[model samples]
Target: MDPLFEFLLRQGDNTLVLGHRISEWCGKAPVLEEDIALANTALDLIGQTQMWLGYAAEVEGAGRTADDLAFLRDAWDFRNLLLLERPNGDFGHTMMRQFLFDAYQIQNLKALEASSDPRIAEIAVKSGKEATYHLDRSRDTVIALGDGTSESNARMQSALDALWPYAGEMFLADEIDQAMAADHIAPLPLEYRAPWEAAVLPALAAAALKVPQDDFAHQGGKTGRRHSEHLGHMLATMQVLQRSYPGATW
Candidate 1:
Protein backbone atom coordinates (compact mmCIF):
# COMPACT_ATOMS: atom_id res chain seq x y z
CA MET A 1 0.00 0.00 0.00
CA ASP A 2 1.14 3.48 -0.75
CA PRO A 3 2.21 5.37 2.36
CA LEU A 4 -0.17 8.21 1.45
CA PHE A 5 -3.09 5.85 1.23
CA GLU A 6 -2.10 4.24 4.50
CA PHE A 7 -1.92 7.62 6.18
CA LEU A 8 -5.32 8.60 4.84
CA LEU A 9 -6.91 5.34 5.96
CA ARG A 10 -5.50 5.77 9.43
CA GLN A 11 -7.01 9.22 9.56
CA GLY A 12 -10.31 8.13 8.06
CA ASP A 13 -10.61 5.03 10.23
CA ASN A 14 -10.04 7.02 13.38
CA THR A 15 -12.80 9.43 12.48
CA LEU A 16 -15.16 6.65 11.41
CA VAL A 17 -14.74 4.66 14.64
CA LEU A 18 -15.03 7.67 16.88
CA GLY A 19 -18.02 8.99 14.96
CA HIS A 20 -19.73 5.62 15.30
CA ARG A 21 -19.20 5.76 19.04
CA ILE A 22 -20.56 9.29 19.28
CA SER A 23 -23.59 8.40 17.18
CA GLU A 24 -24.59 5.93 19.88
CA TRP A 25 -25.40 8.99 21.99
CA CYS A 26 -27.95 10.26 19.46
CA GLY A 27 -31.12 9.36 21.34
CA LYS A 28 -29.39 8.88 24.67
CA ALA A 29 -28.18 12.38 25.52
CA PRO A 30 -29.62 13.77 28.71
CA VAL A 31 -31.33 16.61 26.88
CA LEU A 32 -33.13 16.87 23.56
CA GLU A 33 -30.96 19.74 22.40
CA GLU A 34 -27.80 17.87 23.27
CA ASP A 35 -29.13 14.79 21.52
CA ILE A 36 -29.64 16.73 18.30
CA ALA A 37 -26.27 18.42 18.60
CA LEU A 38 -24.40 15.17 19.09
CA ALA A 39 -26.26 13.50 16.25
CA ASN A 40 -25.38 16.35 13.91
CA THR A 41 -21.75 16.20 14.97
CA ALA A 42 -21.73 12.47 14.41
CA LEU A 43 -23.13 12.89 10.94
CA ASP A 44 -20.52 15.46 10.09
CA LEU A 45 -17.72 13.23 11.32
CA ILE A 46 -19.01 10.18 9.44
CA GLY A 47 -19.38 12.22 6.28
CA GLN A 48 -15.79 13.38 6.55
CA THR A 49 -14.65 9.85 7.17
CA GLN A 50 -16.45 8.62 4.09
CA MET A 51 -14.80 11.18 1.85
CA TRP A 52 -11.34 10.47 3.21
CA LEU A 53 -11.73 6.73 3.14
CA GLY A 54 -13.12 6.80 -0.37
CA TYR A 55 -10.21 8.87 -1.53
CA ALA A 56 -7.84 6.57 0.29
CA ALA A 57 -9.33 3.55 -1.45
CA GLU A 58 -8.88 5.20 -4.82
CA VAL A 59 -5.33 6.10 -3.95
CA GLU A 60 -4.59 2.52 -3.08
CA GLY A 61 -6.28 1.24 -6.28
CA ALA A 62 -8.12 -1.09 -3.94
CA GLY A 63 -11.52 -2.61 -4.77
CA ARG A 64 -12.61 -2.19 -1.16
CA THR A 65 -15.39 0.24 -0.46
CA ALA A 66 -15.45 2.63 2.46
CA ASP A 67 -17.99 0.38 4.17
CA ASP A 68 -15.62 -2.56 3.85
CA LEU A 69 -12.73 -0.50 5.20
CA ALA A 70 -14.80 0.69 8.13
CA PHE A 71 -16.83 -2.35 9.13
CA LEU A 72 -14.89 -5.38 7.91
CA ARG A 73 -11.54 -4.49 9.38
CA ASP A 74 -10.57 -6.10 12.68
CA ALA A 75 -9.60 -4.12 15.76
CA TRP A 76 -5.89 -4.86 15.39
CA ASP A 77 -5.93 -3.18 11.96
CA PHE A 78 -7.26 0.11 13.39
CA ARG A 79 -4.89 3.00 13.98
CA ASN A 80 -6.92 5.48 16.04
CA LEU A 81 -5.20 7.10 18.99
CA LEU A 82 -6.38 5.84 22.37
CA LEU A 83 -8.20 8.99 23.47
CA LEU A 84 -11.06 8.53 21.04
CA GLU A 85 -11.78 4.87 21.81
CA ARG A 86 -12.28 5.33 25.57
CA PRO A 87 -15.78 4.81 26.89
CA ASN A 88 -17.98 7.83 27.22
CA GLY A 89 -18.52 7.62 30.96
CA ASP A 90 -20.80 10.63 31.47
CA PHE A 91 -21.92 13.80 29.76
CA GLY A 92 -18.96 15.50 31.37
CA HIS A 93 -16.59 12.81 30.17
CA THR A 94 -18.01 12.88 26.65
CA MET A 95 -17.70 16.63 26.38
CA MET A 96 -14.17 16.54 27.76
CA ARG A 97 -13.24 13.92 25.20
CA GLN A 98 -14.79 16.02 22.47
CA PHE A 99 -13.02 19.12 23.65
CA LEU A 100 -9.65 17.40 23.66
CA PHE A 101 -10.08 15.61 20.35
CA ASP A 102 -11.74 18.47 18.51
CA ALA A 103 -9.02 20.87 19.62
CA TYR A 104 -6.37 18.66 18.08
CA GLN A 105 -8.51 17.93 15.02
CA ILE A 106 -8.96 21.59 14.18
CA GLN A 107 -5.23 22.10 14.31
CA ASN A 108 -4.64 19.05 12.17
CA LEU A 109 -7.19 19.89 9.47
CA LYS A 110 -5.95 23.45 9.19
CA ALA A 111 -2.47 22.12 8.51
CA LEU A 112 -3.77 19.52 6.09
CA GLU A 113 -5.55 22.20 4.11
CA ALA A 114 -2.14 23.11 2.78
CA SER A 115 -1.10 19.55 2.02
CA SER A 116 0.88 18.65 -1.07
CA ASP A 117 -1.85 16.24 -2.09
CA PRO A 118 -4.73 18.29 -3.49
CA ARG A 119 -7.33 15.65 -2.65
CA ILE A 120 -6.25 15.53 0.95
CA ALA A 121 -6.08 19.32 1.08
CA GLU A 122 -9.57 19.60 -0.37
CA ILE A 123 -11.01 17.18 2.15
CA ALA A 124 -9.34 19.05 4.95
CA VAL A 125 -10.64 22.36 3.65
CA LYS A 126 -14.23 21.13 3.63
CA SER A 127 -14.01 19.35 6.97
CA GLY A 128 -12.26 22.18 8.76
CA LYS A 129 -15.47 24.22 8.93
CA GLU A 130 -17.41 21.43 10.61
CA ALA A 131 -14.50 20.77 12.94
CA THR A 132 -14.41 24.44 13.90
CA TYR A 133 -18.02 24.25 15.02
CA HIS A 134 -17.42 21.02 16.92
CA LEU A 135 -14.49 22.58 18.74
CA ASP A 136 -16.58 25.65 19.64
CA ARG A 137 -19.49 23.65 21.02
CA SER A 138 -17.25 21.26 22.92
CA ARG A 139 -15.22 24.15 24.33
CA ASP A 140 -18.40 25.84 25.52
CA THR A 141 -19.64 22.65 27.16
CA VAL A 142 -16.30 22.15 28.89
CA ILE A 143 -16.48 25.69 30.22
CA ALA A 144 -20.06 25.27 31.39
CA LEU A 145 -19.49 21.95 33.12
CA GLY A 146 -16.18 22.99 34.56
CA ASP A 147 -17.66 26.13 36.11
CA GLY A 148 -21.10 24.80 36.90
CA THR A 149 -22.27 23.12 40.11
CA SER A 150 -19.81 21.40 42.43
CA GLU A 151 -20.82 17.99 41.12
CA SER A 152 -20.45 19.04 37.53
CA ASN A 153 -17.10 20.63 38.23
CA ALA A 154 -15.81 17.57 40.03
CA ARG A 155 -16.98 15.23 37.29
CA MET A 156 -15.50 17.37 34.55
CA GLN A 157 -12.24 17.56 36.52
CA SER A 158 -12.13 13.82 36.85
CA ALA A 159 -12.83 13.42 33.15
CA LEU A 160 -9.90 15.64 32.29
CA ASP A 161 -7.62 13.80 34.69
CA ALA A 162 -8.50 10.42 33.27
CA LEU A 163 -8.10 11.59 29.67
CA TRP A 164 -4.98 13.73 29.98
CA PRO A 165 -2.43 10.97 29.57
CA TYR A 166 -3.94 9.78 26.30
CA ALA A 167 -3.62 13.24 24.80
CA GLY A 168 0.08 12.71 24.21
CA GLU A 169 -0.50 9.92 21.72
CA MET A 170 -1.96 12.35 19.22
CA PHE A 171 1.47 13.81 18.64
CA LEU A 172 3.41 10.59 18.35
CA ALA A 173 4.53 10.11 14.75
CA ASP A 174 5.54 6.87 13.08
CA GLU A 175 6.80 5.80 9.65
CA ILE A 176 3.66 6.85 7.78
CA ASP A 177 3.70 10.24 9.46
CA GLN A 178 7.36 10.67 8.61
CA ALA A 179 6.58 9.89 4.96
CA MET A 180 3.72 12.39 4.94
CA ALA A 181 5.93 15.08 6.44
CA ALA A 182 8.75 14.36 4.04
CA ASP A 183 6.36 14.53 1.10
CA HIS A 184 4.84 17.72 2.52
CA ILE A 185 1.51 15.96 2.59
CA ALA A 186 1.18 16.86 6.28
CA PRO A 187 2.86 18.94 8.90
CA LEU A 188 5.20 17.47 11.48
CA PRO A 189 3.30 16.16 14.49
CA LEU A 190 5.31 18.16 17.01
CA GLU A 191 4.51 21.39 15.18
CA TYR A 192 0.87 21.01 16.15
CA ARG A 193 1.44 20.15 19.82
CA ALA A 194 2.44 23.60 21.10
CA PRO A 195 -0.46 25.30 19.37
CA TRP A 196 -2.86 22.59 20.44
CA GLU A 197 -1.80 23.04 24.07
CA ALA A 198 -2.01 26.81 23.80
CA ALA A 199 -5.53 26.58 22.39
CA VAL A 200 -6.70 24.05 24.99
CA LEU A 201 -5.12 25.53 28.14
CA PRO A 202 -7.07 28.78 28.13
CA ALA A 203 -10.29 26.86 27.71
CA LEU A 204 -9.36 24.62 30.62
CA ALA A 205 -8.56 27.64 32.77
CA ALA A 206 -11.82 29.30 31.79
CA ALA A 207 -13.62 26.13 32.73
CA ALA A 208 -11.90 26.34 36.13
CA LEU A 209 -10.48 22.88 35.49
CA LYS A 210 -6.96 22.01 36.45
CA VAL A 211 -5.00 20.22 33.77
CA PRO A 212 -3.59 17.00 35.12
CA GLN A 213 0.05 17.18 36.16
CA ASP A 214 0.89 13.57 35.45
CA ASP A 215 4.37 13.07 34.00
CA PHE A 216 3.43 9.78 32.39
CA ALA A 217 2.14 10.25 28.85
CA HIS A 218 0.32 7.39 27.19
CA GLN A 219 1.73 6.10 23.88
CA GLY A 220 1.81 3.03 21.58
CA GLY A 221 -1.97 2.78 21.31
CA LYS A 222 -1.91 3.64 17.61
CA THR A 223 -0.46 0.31 16.60
CA GLY A 224 -3.00 -1.38 18.86
CA ARG A 225 -0.26 -2.07 21.40
CA ARG A 226 -2.61 -0.90 24.16
CA HIS A 227 -6.26 -1.75 23.64
CA SER A 228 -9.15 -0.10 25.43
CA GLU A 229 -11.39 -2.66 27.09
CA HIS A 230 -14.32 -0.60 25.87
CA LEU A 231 -13.33 -1.09 22.21
CA GLY A 232 -14.45 -4.70 21.85
CA HIS A 233 -17.91 -3.85 23.14
CA MET A 234 -18.05 -0.83 20.85
CA LEU A 235 -17.01 -2.89 17.84
CA ALA A 236 -19.56 -5.56 18.65
CA THR A 237 -22.35 -3.00 18.70
CA MET A 238 -21.09 -1.34 15.52
CA GLN A 239 -20.41 -4.46 13.48
CA VAL A 240 -22.98 -6.95 14.73
CA LEU A 241 -25.51 -6.24 12.01
CA GLN A 242 -22.98 -6.56 9.21
CA ARG A 243 -21.45 -9.58 10.82
CA SER A 244 -24.81 -11.30 11.13
CA TYR A 245 -26.07 -10.55 7.63
CA PRO A 246 -23.22 -10.47 5.23
CA GLY A 247 -23.71 -8.14 2.22
CA ALA A 248 -26.91 -6.80 3.76
CA THR A 249 -27.34 -3.07 3.35
CA TRP A 250 -30.12 -0.69 2.75
Candidate 2:
Protein backbone atom coordinates (compact mmCIF):
# COMPACT_ATOMS: atom_id res chain seq x y z
CA MET A 1 0.00 0.00 0.00
CA ASP A 2 1.10 3.64 -0.44
CA PRO A 3 2.58 4.57 2.92
CA LEU A 4 1.13 8.05 2.96
CA PHE A 5 -2.31 6.83 2.03
CA GLU A 6 -2.12 4.12 4.68
CA PHE A 7 -0.91 6.65 7.23
CA LEU A 8 -3.78 8.98 6.41
CA LEU A 9 -6.26 6.15 6.85
CA ARG A 10 -4.70 5.33 10.22
CA GLN A 11 -5.26 8.89 11.37
CA GLY A 12 -8.70 9.37 9.87
CA ASP A 13 -10.07 5.97 10.87
CA ASN A 14 -9.16 6.34 14.53
CA THR A 15 -10.74 9.76 14.71
CA LEU A 16 -13.85 8.59 12.85
CA VAL A 17 -14.43 5.59 15.12
CA LEU A 18 -13.76 7.42 18.36
CA GLY A 19 -15.85 10.39 17.28
CA HIS A 20 -18.80 8.16 16.51
CA ARG A 21 -18.45 6.43 19.89
CA ILE A 22 -18.39 9.73 21.71
CA SER A 23 -21.35 11.00 19.75
CA GLU A 24 -23.38 8.23 21.38
CA TRP A 25 -23.43 10.37 24.51
CA CYS A 26 -25.02 13.39 22.81
CA GLY A 27 -28.39 13.06 24.46
CA LYS A 28 -27.38 10.87 27.40
CA ALA A 29 -24.57 12.71 29.15
CA PRO A 30 -25.01 13.10 32.90
CA VAL A 31 -25.72 16.77 32.47
CA LEU A 32 -26.85 19.06 29.70
CA GLU A 33 -23.57 21.01 29.69
CA GLU A 34 -21.54 17.85 29.28
CA ASP A 35 -23.92 16.66 26.60
CA ILE A 36 -23.24 19.84 24.66
CA ALA A 37 -19.51 19.55 25.31
CA LEU A 38 -19.32 15.93 24.14
CA ALA A 39 -21.26 16.85 21.02
CA ASN A 40 -18.81 19.63 20.22
CA THR A 41 -15.84 17.34 20.84
CA ALA A 42 -17.29 14.71 18.54
CA LEU A 43 -17.77 17.36 15.88
CA ASP A 44 -14.11 18.33 16.08
CA LEU A 45 -13.01 14.73 15.57
CA ILE A 46 -15.45 14.14 12.68
CA GLY A 47 -14.24 17.30 10.95
CA GLN A 48 -10.62 16.25 11.27
CA THR A 49 -11.49 12.78 9.94
CA GLN A 50 -13.08 14.38 6.89
CA MET A 51 -10.01 16.44 6.11
CA TRP A 52 -7.60 13.54 6.55
CA LEU A 53 -9.69 11.03 4.61
CA GLY A 54 -10.52 13.59 1.92
CA TYR A 55 -6.79 14.09 1.44
CA ALA A 56 -6.31 10.35 1.35
CA ALA A 57 -8.80 10.12 -1.52
CA GLU A 58 -6.86 12.74 -3.44
CA VAL A 59 -3.61 10.90 -2.86
CA GLU A 60 -5.15 7.63 -4.01
CA GLY A 61 -6.64 9.26 -7.15
CA ALA A 62 -9.19 6.48 -7.32
CA GLY A 63 -12.29 8.71 -7.50
CA ARG A 64 -13.18 8.01 -3.90
CA THR A 65 -14.19 10.86 -1.58
CA ALA A 66 -14.01 11.24 2.20
CA ASP A 67 -17.58 9.99 2.51
CA ASP A 68 -16.75 6.95 0.44
CA LEU A 69 -13.70 6.13 2.50
CA ALA A 70 -15.64 6.44 5.71
CA PHE A 71 -19.03 4.89 4.99
CA LEU A 72 -18.04 2.40 2.37
CA ARG A 73 -15.18 0.66 4.18
CA ASP A 74 -15.81 -2.71 5.80
CA ALA A 75 -14.78 -3.43 9.40
CA TRP A 76 -11.69 -5.30 8.23
CA ASP A 77 -10.63 -2.30 6.13
CA PHE A 78 -10.59 0.23 8.99
CA ARG A 79 -7.10 1.04 10.21
CA ASN A 80 -8.02 2.50 13.57
CA LEU A 81 -6.26 1.40 16.73
CA LEU A 82 -8.11 -1.17 18.81
CA LEU A 83 -8.50 1.17 21.76
CA LEU A 84 -10.74 3.49 19.79
CA GLU A 85 -13.15 0.70 18.98
CA ARG A 86 -13.81 -0.48 22.52
CA PRO A 87 -17.35 -0.10 23.75
CA ASN A 88 -17.86 3.06 25.77
CA GLY A 89 -18.84 1.78 29.18
CA ASP A 90 -19.68 4.25 31.92
CA PHE A 91 -18.89 7.96 31.73
CA GLY A 92 -15.64 7.22 33.50
CA HIS A 93 -14.63 4.66 30.91
CA THR A 94 -15.45 7.02 28.08
CA MET A 95 -13.46 9.89 29.58
CA MET A 96 -10.45 7.73 30.43
CA ARG A 97 -10.45 6.29 26.93
CA GLN A 98 -10.65 9.80 25.54
CA PHE A 99 -7.81 10.98 27.76
CA LEU A 100 -5.43 8.23 26.69
CA PHE A 101 -6.15 8.67 22.97
CA ASP A 102 -6.14 12.48 23.16
CA ALA A 103 -2.80 12.50 24.92
CA TYR A 104 -1.23 10.44 22.14
CA GLN A 105 -3.05 12.47 19.49
CA ILE A 106 -1.75 15.80 20.81
CA GLN A 107 1.82 14.58 20.65
CA ASN A 108 1.29 12.87 17.30
CA LEU A 109 -0.19 16.02 15.81
CA LYS A 110 2.60 18.20 17.22
CA ALA A 111 5.19 16.04 15.49
CA LEU A 112 3.20 15.95 12.26
CA GLU A 113 2.94 19.73 12.25
CA ALA A 114 6.59 19.76 11.18
CA SER A 115 6.00 17.45 8.21
CA SER A 116 7.73 18.21 4.91
CA ASP A 117 4.43 17.56 3.22
CA PRO A 118 2.55 20.87 3.33
CA ARG A 119 -0.86 19.23 3.38
CA ILE A 120 -0.05 17.00 6.35
CA ALA A 121 1.54 19.89 8.16
CA GLU A 122 -1.51 22.06 7.68
CA ILE A 123 -3.87 19.36 8.86
CA ALA A 124 -1.69 18.67 11.88
CA VAL A 125 -1.67 22.31 12.92
CA LYS A 126 -5.45 22.57 12.62
CA SER A 127 -6.15 19.25 14.34
CA GLY A 128 -3.57 19.77 17.09
CA LYS A 129 -5.45 22.78 18.45
CA GLU A 130 -8.62 20.78 18.83
CA ALA A 131 -6.71 17.85 20.29
CA THR A 132 -5.25 20.08 22.99
CA TYR A 133 -8.73 21.07 24.11
CA HIS A 134 -9.86 17.44 24.06
CA LEU A 135 -6.94 16.42 26.23
CA ASP A 136 -7.78 19.10 28.76
CA ARG A 137 -11.44 18.18 28.95
CA SER A 138 -10.79 14.47 29.31
CA ARG A 139 -8.01 14.95 31.86
CA ASP A 140 -10.23 17.09 34.02
CA THR A 141 -12.98 14.51 33.95
CA VAL A 142 -10.56 11.74 34.90
CA ILE A 143 -9.33 13.69 37.90
CA ALA A 144 -12.83 14.66 39.00
CA LEU A 145 -14.15 11.13 38.89
CA GLY A 146 -11.04 9.44 40.15
CA ASP A 147 -10.99 11.62 43.24
CA GLY A 148 -14.71 12.09 43.75
CA THR A 149 -15.88 9.14 45.88
CA SER A 150 -15.40 5.49 46.55
CA GLU A 151 -17.76 4.45 43.79
CA SER A 152 -16.46 6.98 41.29
CA ASN A 153 -12.85 6.14 42.12
CA ALA A 154 -13.47 2.43 41.74
CA ARG A 155 -15.11 2.93 38.38
CA MET A 156 -12.33 5.20 37.21
CA GLN A 157 -9.70 2.75 38.37
CA SER A 158 -11.46 -0.08 36.59
CA ALA A 159 -11.55 1.97 33.43
CA LEU A 160 -7.86 2.68 33.65
CA ASP A 161 -7.03 -1.00 34.00
CA ALA A 162 -9.27 -2.04 31.13
CA LEU A 163 -7.95 0.64 28.80
CA TRP A 164 -4.27 0.39 29.76
CA PRO A 165 -3.62 -2.77 27.81
CA TYR A 166 -4.48 -1.00 24.59
CA ALA A 167 -2.31 2.04 25.25
CA GLY A 168 0.92 0.45 23.95
CA GLU A 169 -0.44 0.00 20.44
CA MET A 170 -0.30 3.72 19.78
CA PHE A 171 3.49 3.59 19.94
CA LEU A 172 3.88 0.39 17.96
CA ALA A 173 5.57 1.38 14.74
CA ASP A 174 5.53 -0.65 11.56
CA GLU A 175 6.57 -0.14 7.94
CA ILE A 176 4.08 2.68 7.51
CA ASP A 177 5.51 4.70 10.39
CA GLN A 178 9.11 4.06 9.35
CA ALA A 179 8.46 5.23 5.81
CA MET A 180 6.67 8.35 7.00
CA ALA A 181 9.50 9.20 9.38
CA ALA A 182 12.19 8.63 6.75
CA ASP A 183 10.35 10.83 4.28
CA HIS A 184 9.92 13.72 6.75
CA ILE A 185 6.20 13.12 6.54
CA ALA A 186 5.86 12.47 10.30
CA PRO A 187 7.86 11.41 13.32
CA LEU A 188 8.12 7.83 14.43
CA PRO A 189 5.33 6.78 16.77
CA LEU A 190 7.82 5.53 19.35
CA GLU A 191 9.41 8.98 19.50
CA TYR A 192 6.21 10.35 20.98
CA ARG A 193 6.08 7.73 23.78
CA ALA A 194 8.07 9.67 26.34
CA PRO A 195 5.98 12.79 25.92
CA TRP A 196 2.73 10.78 25.82
CA GLU A 197 3.73 9.10 29.08
CA ALA A 198 4.71 12.48 30.54
CA ALA A 199 1.27 13.84 29.71
CA VAL A 200 -0.66 10.74 30.82
CA LEU A 201 1.14 9.68 34.03
CA PRO A 202 0.95 12.93 35.94
CA ALA A 203 -2.74 13.19 35.25
CA LEU A 204 -3.17 9.70 36.62
CA ALA A 205 -1.12 10.66 39.66
CA ALA A 206 -3.19 13.76 40.33
CA ALA A 207 -6.30 11.66 40.07
CA ALA A 208 -4.86 9.07 42.49
CA LEU A 209 -5.35 6.45 39.83
CA LYS A 210 -2.80 3.72 39.27
CA VAL A 211 -1.67 2.60 35.82
CA PRO A 212 -1.99 -1.08 35.23
CA GLN A 213 1.33 -2.82 34.60
CA ASP A 214 0.17 -4.91 31.69
CA ASP A 215 2.83 -5.92 29.17
CA PHE A 216 0.35 -7.41 26.73
CA ALA A 217 -0.31 -4.78 24.11
CA HIS A 218 -3.13 -5.62 21.78
CA GLN A 219 -2.44 -4.36 18.26
CA GLY A 220 -2.96 -5.05 14.48
CA GLY A 221 -5.49 -2.41 13.36
CA LYS A 222 -2.74 -0.22 11.92
CA THR A 223 -2.52 -2.60 8.99
CA GLY A 224 -6.21 -3.39 9.03
CA ARG A 225 -5.49 -6.87 10.27
CA ARG A 226 -7.85 -6.84 13.27
CA HIS A 227 -10.67 -4.94 14.90
CA SER A 228 -13.01 -5.21 17.87
CA GLU A 229 -16.53 -6.49 17.27
CA HIS A 230 -17.74 -3.12 18.53
CA LEU A 231 -16.46 -1.43 15.40
CA GLY A 232 -18.57 -3.70 13.19
CA HIS A 233 -21.68 -2.82 15.18
CA MET A 234 -20.78 0.86 15.04
CA LEU A 235 -20.22 0.92 11.29
CA ALA A 236 -23.47 -0.91 10.70
CA THR A 237 -25.33 1.95 12.36
CA MET A 238 -23.12 4.75 11.03
CA GLN A 239 -23.23 3.64 7.40
CA VAL A 240 -26.91 2.78 7.46
CA LEU A 241 -28.26 5.93 5.86
CA GLN A 242 -25.45 6.17 3.36
CA ARG A 243 -25.70 2.51 2.43
CA SER A 244 -29.45 2.47 2.13
CA TYR A 245 -29.87 5.66 0.18
CA PRO A 246 -26.62 5.46 -1.78
CA GLY A 247 -25.30 9.05 -1.61
CA ALA A 248 -28.43 10.84 -0.49
CA THR A 249 -27.41 14.29 0.70
CA TRP A 250 -28.99 17.45 1.91
The most accurate candidate by lDDT is 2
Task: List clashing residue pairs in candidate 1.
Answer: none
Lowest lDDT 10-residue stretch of candidate 1? 219-228
The CA lDDT at 40 in model 1 is 93
Cα TM-score per model: 0.97, 0.98
Model 2 local distance difference test score: 0.93
Model 2: residues with Cα > 4 Å off, grouped in runs = none
Clashes of 1: 0
| Model 1 residue 232 CA deviation in Å | 2.0
What is the Cα-based lDDT of residue 72 in candidate 1?
84
Best by TM-score: 2
Question: RMSD in angstroms, candidate 2?
Answer: 0.8
lDDT string for model 1 (192-241, tens) is 89999999999999999998888577765576666677777888889898
Model 1 regions more than 4 Å off: none
